[model samples]
Target: MFKHLLPRMRERSAAANRPVSLSDMMEEFWREPFGNLSPLFRDAGYPAVDVSEADGVVTVKAELPGLDPKDVTISVENDALILRGEKRFEDEQKKDDYHRIERAYGSFSRVVPLPGKVKEAEAKARFEKGVLTVTLPRDAAEAVRNIPIEGA
Candidate 1:
């Protein structure tokens, strides 16, 4: 019954640079019943992120729909900015039955590499609407350092 999905599983595994077992493929296949309806419905990767730097500030924006600000955790560690969060799905089905759940839910973590050193203590984050924006001011000293030239 699921023989047709093997090729797709292999492609997905190869994209991630890892091997996918039959059980793992089955689990993912069952997780989304209407996954092939459209690209929007497919779990192509959650919380799509964009990182940009300008005017001595590094900004990271992530799309996190249906998630509260409290559900997210932002931190800078090891020269990278880490974002961790979860999207919980609550179905209060009293009479209507769910035909499809296109929204991918569960916990997710995204690590963005910093363009330069940032002042961790001065970082600021704000969650407005479904977008999460994190602003990190670059460390003036570390961002640009000059070394004296010694002639041999």
Candidate 2:
């Protein structure tokens, strides 16, 4: 039935290099077979993100071409860092229409969980040259705690 057909369909899709249908995209979002695949497909045009941790700071940088800083939003809830933004496509109406449209538009979000608790007040973010940089300072006490060993 569908179980056998799914693999063949996937292989056909790969061979054709066609974009997955919107319904299939929704299904993948719900199943989350590969974890965070939604964002990857939703914002396929955007460059990959870079995350780094050093000492007590965590840095995340993402490339968002043609996106304005005002359209981007960054927030922290609990131990998760959330980045949300929109990429608007310019409207063009001409006698000669476009044959193909590939760039993605609309809202995108990326939620990254911190390795340890962070100082929300100290978190800083900057955007320049179509790149967004978010810096989160790790809470010192939460970063590491000495556990006293006792003889049993």
Candidate 3:
């Protein structure tokens, strides 16, 4: 009796593993039946981040869609860099206008620890096209030192 549905189920299972489509599948996998699932449908608040270090600086890039510069905050202390922001859902829908909605909205925070100390006063942050880029200049003196070694 369930033989006909096997192929369709298999197709969906296969699609869930595709790199680009895996996120959607994961979201759907957690959805509950016949309940208020608005929160679940909202965007995964955490943004994707990338970090790179060169010479005496570390660069971090975070993807924050539909966010204003003032809404985001970046800070570093004791070798730790933190990113925090809130995503608000301001859209209002009429009783008979919408069928399905899937966009995350809420407060999100991400903290990253740097491998070395940075010059707090020299840190820089920029926001463009929904991406936040932060550049932290390392303390040059703290990054290197000559230790005298006596032959044993």
Q: TM-score: which candidate is best? A: 1
How well is each residue in 5-49 modelled by candidate 2, as lDDT tens digits? 766666766677763555455666677655655776755534457
Off by over 4 Å in 1: 1-45, 145-152
Clashing pairs in 1: none
Q: Model 1 compared with the native: what TM-score?
A: 0.65
TM, every model: 0.65, 0.64, 0.62
Using lDDT, give the best candidate's number.
1
In model 2, pairs of residues that clash are none
Whole-model lDDT per candidate: 0.84, 0.79, 0.79
Superposed model 2: Cα runs more than 4 Å off: 1-47, 92-96, 146-152
**CA RMSD, predictions in order:** 9.2, 9.1, 10.3
Instruction: Give candidate 2's error at residue 41 in angstroms.
Output: 8.9
